[model samples]
Target: MFEVGFWELALVGVVALVVFGPERLPRVARETALWVRKARTMMASVKEEINHELDLQDLKQSLLEQKKLPNTATDNLNQNILRRRQATEILAEQFEPGEAAPEKEPHD
Candidate 1:
């Protein structure tokens, strides 16, 4: 995202060399690179999570709109079943195999 030219990078390198000296510059650069990589990875993960949440919200909104419209008993029952199936699938995706899922309570 930065528009740093070759000269700008060279300038920064020169300053870092002068400040950190030859003895410690390599280690400093390595640590800085590691931190940048970690930050980039974390940012990517956050972006993925946000997109997933938005998709779920869209699905919920559409389901609500569908319920608001006039529909027969069969349609409503089918929609309820579909919603439960979708929700269970979503939950299953979040857990690894061998992990315990939360126990469901009796509805009535």
Candidate 2:
């Protein structure tokens, strides 16, 4: 996002060299690079978590709307069964074998 020209970078380098001297400049630069990398990774994780929370809110809103629909008892029962089956299938798709599944209640 920074639009630093070659001259600006050269100026920064000159200043750094004068302030740190030849002996400590390389170590300072290495530490600066590590800090920049860690900041970038932390920002990415924060963005990902925010997006996940927004998606979860959207899903909850849609589920509430689904339950508010006017329908007969038979239609409501069928829709709930269908919804549960869809949820189970979604969970199954995310798992590798048995690693991701939750225990289900036994249906008689």
Candidate 3:
């Protein structure tokens, strides 16, 4: 993000070495590394949480669509079943006493 090139980094290192001296430079570098690592980990965790929330919203929308379809399908199925049952009763009444039962076939 800083977009620092090799020359910039070399200049910063030279300045740091002169200002902090060899004795404190390594300790400062170590502390800086630790802080950067912590910041990156925190940022990653935040990103993951945001993504999880977005996924949950998408899942909720999918479930809502699925929920509507099933209700409509169930209502249609109930109407169809009622109509078939009425037709079956009418057919049964028309049959003669000794007539065979209606053929039972499974269809999809």
Query: In model 2, which residue pairs have backbone atoms overlapping below 3 Å?
Result: none
Where does model 2 exceed 4 Å of error? 70-108
Q: What TM-score fits each model?
A: 0.62, 0.63, 0.62
Q: What tens-digit string does per-residue lDDT give for candidate 1 at 17-90?
A: 99999999999999999999999999999999999999999999999888867566778999999999999998
What's model 1's TM-score? 0.62
* CA-lDDT, candidates in order: 0.94, 0.93, 0.96
Residues 27-91 of candidate 2: C-alpha lDDT, one tens digit per residue: 99999999999999999999999999999999999988777674566688999999999999997
Model 2, global lDDT? 0.93
Q: Report the number of backbone clashes for model 2.
A: 0
Give per-residue lDDT, candidate 2, residue 23: 100
Candidate 3 deviation (Cα RMSD): 9.6
Top of the candidates by lDDT:
3
